[model samples]
Target chain A: MIANILDGIVLGLQFGLLAAGLTLVYGLGGVLNLAYGQMAVISAIVITLALSAGVPVLLAVALGLFVGGLAGLILDLTILRPVYRLRGEPRVLLSLLLTLGVSFIIDGFLNWRYPLETLSLRIPGEAVEILGVPMRRGSLIASAITLVTFAALFGFFRYTSLGRAVRSVIQDQEGARLVGIYPHRMLRLILVLSGVLAGLVAVTRSMVTPVDAQSGLSITVFALIVTVVGGLGNVAGALLAGIILGIVSVIAANLIGTYISLIILLAAAALTILIRPAGLLGVKE
Target chain B: MLKVKSLSAGYQGNDVVHQVDFEVGSGEAVMIIGSNGAGKTTLFRAMCGLLVPSSGQVFFEGTDISGAPAERIARLGLRFVAAERHLFPQMTVHENLLLGANPYRPDPKTMSLILDLFPRLAERRRQHAGTMSGGEQQMLAVGRALMSKPRLLVLDEPSTGLAPLLAQAAYEALGALRKQGLTVLVAEQQVPLAMSFSERGYVLENGYIKLQGTAQELAANPIVRRAYLGVT
Candidate 1:
């Protein structure tokens, strides 16, 4: 049970990071990026290709992360241009449809080109013992990276002026404008940041299990579940919900079975909605 | 410092403020007085670039700023504080104030001035803006706008939700800022408070400027007294 919980923590940290990216974009600009998972898959594929071309591991990962951010920037400069012209429900609907289309196109292209490509970052080390349970070095390293990323993210949002401007847009677009912060510029920046986060999740997840061309849908689904269970646009809520759901999924899989654990996770998310519709830490609208 | 020429604006295709011509010279305290739904808000919104004007031009410091986006206008040093005070509710008072100087570092001297102007804001610097009382929120709203050291501070119904005493107190703060030589253009429904604070005034009725004169002139005008001042 201790080992399972530890493993769940490892997974939960990734889940939290994934949801943070999705939530920020939705909160900042009402843009629901359905192609988010495809971004991660593309990053993973980029890293795999770079590695096969004999690039150093670190450089390959960096290249992947850059590509991820570039993907977001491209999205903003292209399809999201029309989406920004809209307001309220129409904006959300149009963004969803457009990003869904983008996702399908990306998924199809990846399947056709790299059908067997996968990313598996092997951290060569013996299993480390923690609390009398043996943990894989890759898992430990991945969790460390995730924790550090979260800390940096929190610090950026809390301490930096640029980060505050981003938060201001999320809180109130008009208020942000009154302060001379352009909503569109902030949205573009966040989309890029979200892409980098997606890439980071793909990299970390690959350290635990291989991430392949077909992993995009599952990634997006997991992110959506964590995002909803956390709150649509609340970062801290995402972290909390991610960990709780992570543990529930692991424990359920241990006690019942792996296939049923996904359903169990969905049930937990549903229960959270029924009980606190605003999410665990979401502000009541 | 600001000029509007034949400005007409409204929601959709309907013009709520029609042919509204007004100007505020440097260091002047100007007021646009009107009752609720009399197009005061619409006029201010159009001038500040929050709404696109159907036909007209707005000149700030002799440069045309008509139909510009709100953020661009703000960066040009004309900040608008809406009646609803669109503050970041989840953020602390300090964060909200800091954002008012966004894209630029918060100047220490200006920060000190604002805090001194509103001691209550200093006291609640760490408190979330949404949790503050209506009066304190009003102070924060004005203080936040002041952080940018704007050339012209355009305010819309600053006294909207405040108690009678608090409303007067808000004008008192604005009065103090005016004494500091800051240019101000305010829209107020509370005619007496505004009349006392502003040197020049314009009366907006329906969608047009009905009267423009000195405060004393408007205060003594029989029509103004009968319609707004509640004096027999």
Candidate 2:
């Protein structure tokens, strides 16, 4: 049970990080990026291709991150241009449809080209013992990377002027404008940041399990679940919800079965929605 | 410092403020006074680039700023404080003030000046803006705008939600700023408070400028006293 809980925590940290990227875009720009998972999968594929070409591991990962950021920048500059002209419900709907279309195109292209490609990073080491339970070095390292990223994100948002401007857009767009902070510019910046985060998640996840061309949909689904439970735009809420749902999924799989756990996770999210519609930490809009 | 030529603006295709013409010279405290529904808000919104004008141009410091986006206009040193305040509710008072100086570092001198102007804001430095009382929020709205060290401050209905005493206090702060040579253009429904604060005034009636004169002239005008001042 301790091992399952520990493993769940490891999984939850990734879930939180994934949700943070999705939530910020939605909150700041009202753009629901359905292609978010595709961004991650592409990054993983890039890393895989670079490794096959004999590039150093670190350089390959860096290249993957760059591509991921480029993907986000492209989305913002291209399809989202029309989406930004809209307001309120129409904006949300248009963004959803356009990004979904983009996601399909990416998924189809990747599946056709790299049908058998997958990213699986092998961290060579013995299982490290913690609290009398043996934990894989890969899991330990992934968790460490995720924690550091979260800390960096928190510090950036809390301490930096640029980070505050981003938050100001999310909080009150007109207020941000009154202060000379352009909402569109902030949205573009967040898209790039979110892309980098997507790449990081793919890299970290590959250490635990292989990330493949077909992984996009499931990744988006997991991110959506965590995002809803955490509150749409609230970062801290995402982290908390991610951990809770992670433990619930692991414990359910341990008790019942792996297939049943997915249903249990959905049920848990449904229950959370019924009780707190805005999400665990979301303020009523 | 500011000029409007035949400005007409409104929602959708309908013009709410029509052919409005006014100007404020450097360091002048100008007031646009009107009762409810007199199009004061619409005029200010159009001039500040929050609402696009259907016809006419707005010149700030001799440069045409009509149809410019609000952020761009703000960066050029004309800041608008809307009646709604539009503050970041989840952020602390300090964060709100910090953002008012965006794309530039918050000046220590400006920060100290604002805190001195609104002691209530200094007291609630760490409190979330949404949690503050209406009066405190008003101070914060003005304080946040002032943090930018704007060359001209445009405010819409600053006294909208405040109590009678608080309304007086809000104007008092503006009065103090004007004494410091800050250029201000304010839209006010509370005519008497505005009359005392502004040197020059324009009476806007149904989207048009009905009268333009110095404060004493408007205060003594029979129509102004009857319609706005509530004097028999």
Candidate 3:
């Protein structure tokens, strides 16, 4: 039971990273990029392909991460910007469709490239024993990576000028503009940051489980659930919600079956919607 | 210093402010007074570049700023405090004030001055801005704008919803800022209060400037008194 719980937490922390990206985009751009998961999957694929081409693992991972940032920038410039000029329900519906369409295109290309194969990272380390628990060395490393990344993110928002500008834009676009902070420029930075985060999640998760081309959709769905359960645009909520969801899923799977986990997730999301539409930590606008 | 030449602007496809013209010299206080929906806010929006004018130009310090983006205008040392009081509610008062000074390296003296100007805000400096009362939030909005030490400060309905005492207090604060040589362009619906502070005033009606004069002259004009000052 402890091992199952630990596994769930490991998965949850990685999901937290992905959900944070999604929430940031939605908060700033009001766009739920369905292509978000594809961005991660593409990073994984790039690393795998580089390794196959005789590239070292570290260099391949670096290249994959770089692509992630580039993909985010491209998406922002091409797809999200024009849609953001719109208002009301039209803006919401249109951006949703546009991102979904992009998701399909990415998924199709990835499927063509990899077919039915899956990719996994092989770290050269032995499992470690801690307090009577035998832990996979890779999981321990992934947790460490998540912790460092989260800390860095916190520091960026709290201390850096660019990060503060992003926060101001998220709070009120016109207000930010009045203070000489351009929302569009901030939006670009956010998308790039989002890409970087998704890339990190890709590399970390691919270490533990095999990631296939079709994995993008499931990843996107899980992240979306976590974001919703946490609160739409709340970063801390996403992190907390991710862990809770992770624990609940594992417990549900243990008590019933793997299929019951989905039911549990859906229920949590439904309860949140009915009781707290703004989300647990979402600021009521 | 600011100048507006035949400025016309509005929302969507409709023009709410048409061919309005005005000017304000450096360190001068000018008021644009109008009834609700008489284009005061709309004109302010165009001047700040939140709305592009359909026709006309705005020059700030002789630079043609018409159609320039709001951020660009703000960078040029003109700050607009919208009447909505768009404070980052989740953030503390100190953080909000810090963001106001974000364009330039923040000065501790300016923060101290703003805190002095709004003692209520200083008392709640550590509190989240959104939790404050409306009057307190309004003060914070104006105080935040002052954080940048703007060359020109534009206020939209600064005391629109406040109690009479709060409104008086807000104007007194502005009066103190004016004494410090802050060039101000204020849009107001409260005719008497506005005229009391401004050296010059313009009366806007249906998107056009119906009258313009020295504050005392406009205040004493029988027509102005009957129409806007609630007197026979």
Candidate 4:
């Protein structure tokens, strides 16, 4: 049980990395970021394509991340910005519908262009033992990289000029405008960061699972569940809640395998809703 | 200096402020007073570049800044402190204070000067602005506007929700700013005891200036007495 718990810590860290960016998008802008899963998919595809192109592996990964960010900017400019120009719930509802259309479009285009087998990358075979734990070298490495990156992002948001501008826009639009901080600039930043985060997830996913054209919506469900179950507008809270939920499932898997994991997921989600409808760390009105 | 000529503005083209004309020279104070639906706020919003006029122009500092973006207009040393907006409720009070100085970020010396100007804010500098009393937050809002070191300060209604003493204090602060050569334009329902604090004020009703004169001149008018001063 103790060993399994330790293993679960590593797993929890992975999910935290994957979900943190999505959570921040939701927290800062109140957008569900429906296309976030595509970030991971595209990152993986870019890495795979670079390898096929004879590019260096590290360069391929960096390019993959860049691809994700570019995709975020494109989505912001093309899809999200138009909807954002509208007012209130309609803005949210329209983006949800439009991004859903975009998901289908992206999936179809990827399917048409790349055969499913070409995109899959099996784990670079290696085991690394650390802190008395044996873990997949890729998972450990990605997890470590993610933890450090998120820490830096957290620090930036907590103590930087631009981050404060973004936070001001999120906290109160009029107040930000009162100080002459343009919400439009913050909106653009949101889109770019969304791409960066999505790309991070995509890179890690390519290493672990085969990404089919149909894979976009599958992981989105999990990210949504993580975001909502954590909180609607609190990134740090989403992390805590995501990791907690991650541990719950991992423990269930080690103790009872897949059967009990679903039960645990359902039960924990229900309890979370019953206890804190605003998620664990959502700002109260 | 700010000037509006034939300024006509409204929500959705309904024409609330009808061909209004006004000007505030440097180191001058102006006020607009009106009852509900008189379009006073709309005129203020329009003059400050928040609302675009339908068929008119606004020139600030002798530049045709009509239809300029609100943020850009703010950057040009004309700042508007809106009524009843509390932007960052969840952050610490210090955080809100720092944001006021953002556009002027290159000048930390201005920030200290701003703090010195509003000593009450400096004392509670570390407190969360949201938790502050209505009066304190209003002061913070105005102080934040001062961070930009605006040549012209436009306040919608500094007296709303404040006690008489607090309102007087707020007006006194405006007086001090005006004393230091900052142009001020205030819109309020209650006439200050002396408009001595302000050089001039205009009374608006039904989207036009019902009365305009030196602050004391308007204050002494029979119409002004009935409309605002409640003099029998």
Flag regions of model 1 displaced more than 4 Å: none
- Lowest-scoring 10 consecutive residues by lDDT in candidate 1 chain B? B41-50
The estimated TM-scores of all candidates read 0.99, 0.99, 0.96, 0.91
Docking verdict class for candidate 2: high
Q: What is the TM-score of chain A alone in each candidate?
A: 0.98, 0.98, 0.95, 0.90
lDDT of 1 at A27: 85
**lDDT of every predicted structure (CA atoms):** 0.92, 0.93, 0.87, 0.75
The DockQ scores of all candidates, in the order shown, are 0.92, 0.92, 0.83, 0.59
Candidate 4 — which residues are off by over 4 angstroms? A26-31, A117-133, A206-212, A254-277, B193-196
Model 2, residue B100: distance off in Å is 0.8
iRMS values in order, in angstroms? 0.7, 0.7, 0.9, 1.6
| Reference-based lDDT, residue A85, model 2 | 98
Error of 1 at A266 (Å): 1.7
lDDT per residue, candidate 4, B1-232, as tens digits? 7888998899996999898888898888888777667887788777666777787888888888887767778778888887774448766656776787667673678677767767888888778777888888888888878777888889888887899998888888888777788888888877654355667878788888767888779878998887678888
Which digits, one per residue and each the tens of the lDDT, describe model 2 over residues B18-54?
9999999999999999989999988988888788999
For residue A51, what is the lDDT in candidate 1? 98
- Which window of ten consecutive residues has the lowest lDDT sum in model 1 chain A? A276-285
Tens digit of per-residue lDDT, candidate 1, span B35-117 = 89999988888888788999999999989999999999999999999999999999999999999887678998999999999
Model 3 scores a TM of 0.96
Model 3 clash pairs?
A: none
lDDT by residue for model 3 (A183-268), tens: 88887888888887888888888777788788888888888888888887678888888888888888898889999999898898
